[model samples]
Target: AKVVASPIELCQFNGISRRDKTAQQKPMIEVISSTDFQVLSCINQIKQNMFLQFPERRLIQYDCGKLQTLDVLLAQLKREKHRCLIFTQMTKMLDILELFLNYHGYTYVRLDGTTQIVQRQMLMERFNSDEKIFVFILSTRAGGIGVNLTGADTVIFYDSDWNPTMDAQAQDRCHRIGQTKDVHIYRLISKNTVEENILKKANQKRLLGDLTIDGGSFDVNYFKKNNIRDLFDQSSTLEDIVRERNEYQQKLDTSRTTIAVAATKTTTTTTITNSSNPDSNLTLTQYEEALAAVEDETDRRAADELNKEVRNE
Candidate 1:
């Protein structure tokens, strides 16, 4: 009979229990009597089956205790020559992991909220083409959408987001239409941490309400209580702010586009009216265009001034 090791036992085997005398480390292993090992075994078998059936993609959740276990998994993936994407809710945590990976001589690409649009496109291209870059560290909020990352067949959620939908969105980035191989998702949830509790609450809330709020009438107190600032706040977790901000920004962009289109139409109508009705009183379109031109100039000046104020802030 094949012996299946417990998570704690696996951690110990990975050298997670070895400690430095000078630095204090949290107990790397925790006993979970309630954990269903039989179910896990069955699930593992199912995963293997799905891997065969789908042969193109698979999703699996690994609820393990120690980070070292993740290191071990990554090592196995490296040996198998698997390209992977890792999603994190915190940019700070993403940075820390990037640094750790770099120190360990792992070649990876990191993309977060601070990454510019052009830079993001460049990184995506590199990730797709460069076999040397086996890992892509992504901030869930910034790098989650609007990019095709079919090159990677595996996605690891280093931590759970409040909303499972957010996690799904991140995973779909890899498992989308273009992906040819079986994609596997590994969700690492620390056994009894706030991370687990947060997931439960978020999932419950999702069942009650929508996964995210629509464009208008958000609660200001919620932001205050959470210490969230405009989706890009360092203090707020990437999942909490970025999704909402991205949706809002999309709405704003659409509104701006509509306004610009309307303005152009008004200008064209005015030009046509001026040519046709030479001696008649100026048409409404002509008046509207002149008004719009003045408004546009005023808005541009106001935006520049507002930008200066924001820079000072």
Candidate 2:
């Protein structure tokens, strides 16, 4: 039986682009498991859908929608002298935010994947300690990588992420322990499109997480189950399925081996020590082992779908 893959590339985009490539010429499309996607992918797709829907306003400014909302919120926050964290999925979008902040003459700092290792800590410290800096523009993932910005009481998720946990982690950059004032989170969603779909998926995932944590039952995907036989003819024998599965397994094994070797060579050891000392004094070695165990579990879970497909075969 053939499994219909969830195509990563946006579909129903049959219009022609004004270039060598036609709109019909789609990007490399393939179904990736839920683990392969992050919130940023949905953000990019929604941005594409917006421009696709509104072809006339190609030169329109970026801040017309969320920026207006941002202006009103920041104005009030400035009056209260409350610092804020602004996060976007796309770095180019971060550039737009930089422009908006510059237009308003708001002193701000920035952090992204490109920021140098030495400069990141310095930048975070300045944003936290400096009174002049009123805003911090950050890439969603980069902001939460290593630095802590608890000085900001308000967080603006400049865009939506498909994975709800990603946004949640970014929001906590300010709302975590040692935060004094009440924290506020604002997620800017486009009017309608894949973004709204992403929001629905995110909410469902959030509900699932809550249910699991609370000892309740939940379904990951809300779709109805169907039999594998529906995808193939009745004449297709078990041997044919086994051969197809074996060939795919061999290819996957090769890919996995290559990836594992590359990862092993590039992986670096980082130090982690629990300083809270809240009664349990877990040693650095033990902490590292526990972290490794979690990492292993995450890797296995990411590959669980492949394992399940094999078992079905």
Candidate 3:
């Protein structure tokens, strides 16, 4: 019988990104007997499934759909001589990924909170110089900043951070100034799960970033809502999640377009007021044309799928 693996749903937290702190740490034997997956059963199931699928030469069930897609992407990218940087939030998840890499005979280097500061630089240097190393598995926070890994051209977000900027910083590791090849970044988000909601909230925060960059006076409180219960509750169906994502995107796009128009008008007004020349109707007309073009592009994009990222395999 075939086992369909679901993407491991990580716990949602406010402010700091961390694993369940209240979870009791226990021996393997104790954990095995416990039904609490928060401790170790989740990773155990993944390893068990990997062995189950070993004889078939197909690593289809890796206890998560994200890993299945990564399995295919890794194989294809390796053949093309493209190195990869895989980022996940939890170090335990890194351990699970390492197990998968070892089982598949893929050479990799890992860095997380446990790695010594002196050894972290050494590992980075080794991964950068060694063309034989196919992947660099890293915990998102530890490897996210103050590291340059230009050797790899592809990046995969095994799981996204609650804060969008953290994920963005992690992505910049491979897409920085020293990189030559076109960098490709992928974020794996499980559909119809808590991850979908997390992504939506993250996107909203990103939109706030865009607004701040555009010099729009938008209150950060606009995105905040008393919806924590909705985020963790799994009663929402697939259609409900999709609709929410699309509706939210449309609203965000509309707000962006409005902000753009306001900024354009403000700029045009300031220029007209300061300039000695009065025939600045041309400038206003030009701004109107640019705004129209932006609106048209936004409309075109709004018609497309909201969640372009793939769900669990």
Candidate 4:
């Protein structure tokens, strides 16, 4: 299971955490530098730091961005006729993707915060019955957990969630008790940004969850006198433990990135020599070469990510 995000700086990120907001300060400054738009969306001046508002606003266009990542993945899935679950934290993200998927002619069902609890089951049942419905769009927090849709053999996180546990639960929507085929999970992360850091943190949290639940035996200190206090003393408070754990996790993630990059390093560029037409430059072979180069880059990145997953295991 993985956490995914399509980062193209397309959305007005609302209610961002202080740490992440601070990390994106430079990009926000760039946006301010380029445009004359003053943010007016946040009511309280002091509290309105995370969002950028303008008189007229536009998200980064879908092509050549994260949507392109989805296009490639979804195409292969369509060829195999594999059912899919596409999960995102934001309904607005779902709205945009719905448009993209519909334009591509995929039949899909959706569930979000607005869907009533009573109607949720009915929608899931509808999706389950119709094999022709190839996709399910779900808001991760609202409808990801407890809903069983084993029809889909693929689970994709359109964006990462702050809570690692929620992301894991979202994956379980497809990897449920009665699934017959092997499930494939893809987390589409933007390269070289705060989004990458965020995913590292989430994966570390996932590792912690695994350590807590996994393993064969408990430590001797767990049986010591003042057992409850001893437990608290061993790690301090739960909050403190989490804080210390995250502080230690950063070092581990650094090394993991080093290993992943080392193991999956590949050439992503090629020199195309076209001398067929002296007068003009554009040709079918050249166009195909450009597309292949883009695909090669995408595949290289995916392979690198898969290597990371293997190491994580």
RMSD of each: 23.5, 27.9, 23.5, 29.6
Residue 7 accuracy (lDDT) in model 1: 70
Top model number, TM-score: 3
Candidate 1 achieves a global lDDT of 0.62
- Against the reference, the lDDT scores of all candidates come to 0.62, 0.62, 0.68, 0.64
lDDT tens string, model 2, 192-291? 4445545554555454344321222223332111211122334434344446556655665675566556556665432223334334444434533443
lDDT of 3: 0.68
Indicate which candidate wins on lDDT.
Answer: 3
Task: Give the C-alpha miss distance for residue 118 in model 3, angstroms.
Answer: 2.1
User: In angstroms, how far off is 88's CA in candidate 2?
Assistant: 0.6
- Residue-pair clashes per prediction, in order, are 5, 1, 0, 0
| Residues 42-160 of candidate 1: C-alpha lDDT, one tens digit per residue | 89999999776644311211223445666787889999999999988667677667655765667999887667679989999999889899899986656534678988999998887
Per-residue C-alpha lDDT of model 4 across residues 1-313, encoded as one tens digit per residue: 8955444232334556556766889788888866644444334563544333321112323544678878888999999999999988666777777777767888998887677657889988888888999899987766623588888899998877644776776898788898899999988766554455455545554554443212223221111122212323332333443576677677667745654464466433322233443444444345334434654343334334433544576
| Cα deviation of 312, candidate 1, in Å | 28
| Sliding window of 10 residues with minimal summed lDDT for model 2 | 222-231
